[model samples]
Target: MPNIQFFALAESVCKKLNLPPIPFPVRKGRDEIIFNPQGVALDLLLDELEQYLIEKPEEKIFYKDAFSRLAAIEGIRLGEEGFHDHAAHYFELGLALDPANLALRSNYALSLQSAGRKEEAMRQYRFLLQQPVISGQCLVLIPAARLFLDCGDPVTAHQIVKHCASFMPVDNEFWDLFAEARQRCGIKRWMAPRQKQQEIMRQATAPDYKSAPTGKKKNFCPACGNRLKPGARFCGGCGHAL
Candidate 1:
């Protein structure tokens, strides 16, 4: 159980690290949970905690939980205050203790993006996307697609969403972003029927199907090689109506 001494120790640690005063949430009849601190460099603080844990090896689990939680809370606070670099630092501290914490990784990626570290942010997003737990969920994929869109790579964003959007459950947010990406990639609008959009995307992504050379005209639908009736507006084979 934490007490006044541990709280004082954490405050001193904060002072030593040149950070702002963190209000340690003291739970009644429980441990004094000291906030790791926001708005400061936490590398030193983490190092200190590590060294302390080394000396008192038996208390590792307790200290790790408390400190990692503290890091997340303070890191989020720092991010809210527009200190994105510091926030990222705190998130890294938390991740050191809980490497599999998706929340910390997500926040860390956002912090990196806000700090103008776009490449690092993309890397983090990719890592999240690769995790089995994400399972192509828009929670990570949409943000990653947005990053590509923001980077003037709408084609990539379109590519990311188009393939997955076909199979995933419909989400308004995902569709909205999908439409924005599609528009940037030269699609006229997102209000088109889902089937129509898929057809367009299929054509857009499909390999080039050349028409007859010279004066001759192709006699079939390029998408599925279905024989086309003259003046037909859609393909009967694969519904390749544009």
Candidate 2:
């Protein structure tokens, strides 16, 4: 996966060290639209970042900020062209930066959803909604709602939309989605329920007739009601070897 945003932590460290800013989602052999952070500068920054982490374990905010920025870059990449590599990398950074940050977690969930990792993304959303801090912000709420809808869990989607009801206006996209959410919620009820499939029994023996005194008689296997031989070691009609 090619991430468009390079490590902002690395970029920040390099900038402080008076090095060139390396952008992310490195496109090899193409014109460097973003900064590249692979050579000596990258090495130095990585070493420094590790050392910094060791030296000051309390600077959680700084690390979190770096990750949040990286996640934002991922969201941008998703909007631009729905690139999973860039999206997933940024999401990892965001979660790594601040695991407690529901916003970051939510964003990462959306990234995973866009990347076709529905269950993983749904897990993240469920975790995020469990937190007492979840609110109706579009960035967080919209994607969460979308994920629920996509998962055939429209009930949850409706709850999310209703929770954000105050935030919606007449022309807002949420209003349309709210309606969709309702429709999705009731979709199963309106549609005819699917019938259960019964197992088909295979024939144990082929059809055969027996010559009885009064009339022709038939002996069939109980499993498939197929014809069978009387007192034979095997069923010649259907090859049911006794």
Candidate 3:
């Protein structure tokens, strides 16, 4: 359910490319993201927080709430640990803080789908579709339709894309998305060079760009030439501020 940007960044990570990585939604409640975390560390933080929430149980957790931000941060870390259940826990916590939060809802839905609750995932997507004041972020819709197709209802999936094609913007990015949706719907002809370009763009902005070295000795941030290893005010040599 994350925006196209999130998936695109994930795809980039999957392909080991470096560019503008997709971002996890950061607008969730304070209980969602844990920034500048120190001695608590990643491993024990979630456990401790879970216990804390249990004993104190407050009302209306949202992005502004400290606990909610921490929960979001830990949730992302849990996801990286391949602990899908824990990941869902934090995502839900994030949603609890901000129910109408498209980012959390979308991501939680994807986690459900990935965890093999296909029907539940589709139900979430349907709910997202029914939002009358939705943003122009068609990324969530396109991917969900593909999921439906893979779940053995090409007819419904086809309808999904056909109805959404109008919502799609006029650009190569969306054209590629349509191409992919059509291909998922059994329109083999949509698999063309444009779609290939889209795939390339997806690869470009994936997560963990440094997982595989980019054949460069120095891992300077290409954007600002900032030396990445920390403890420096700027690039000691390039003067790019850290």
Q: After superposition, how far is residue 131 of candidate 3 from its true place, in Å?
A: 1.7
**C-alpha TM-score for every candidate:** 0.51, 0.48, 0.47
Q: What's the lDDT for residue 21 in model 1? A: 53
Residue-pair clashes per prediction, in order, are 0, 7, 24
After superposition, candidate 3 runs with Cα above 4 Å error: 1-50, 58-64, 133-135, 163-242
Tell me the tens digit of each residue's lDDT in model 1 across 164-188.
6876646767777788998999988
* Candidate 3 C-alpha lDDT tens digits along 1-242: 22111112245442442223323232224223333343224333334445444543562342124444555566666667777677777778767656777767777777777677788889888888787654345667667777877787766666666666776455565455556557666777664456678889988887764565466566675656656775555566666755
CA RMSD per model (angstroms): 17.6, 18.5, 29.7
**lDDT tens digits, residue span 1-242, model 2:** 23222344355564654433433222243323233454333323333343444555675555545435545544555546868656666566656756776666766777788788889888888888888777645577777887788778889998997788776444446666777888877753221111111112223353446665675676776555667767866666566655
Best by lDDT: 1
TM-score of 1: 0.51
Summed over model 3, clashes come to: 24
Q: What does the lDDT read for residue 55 in candidate 3?
A: 49
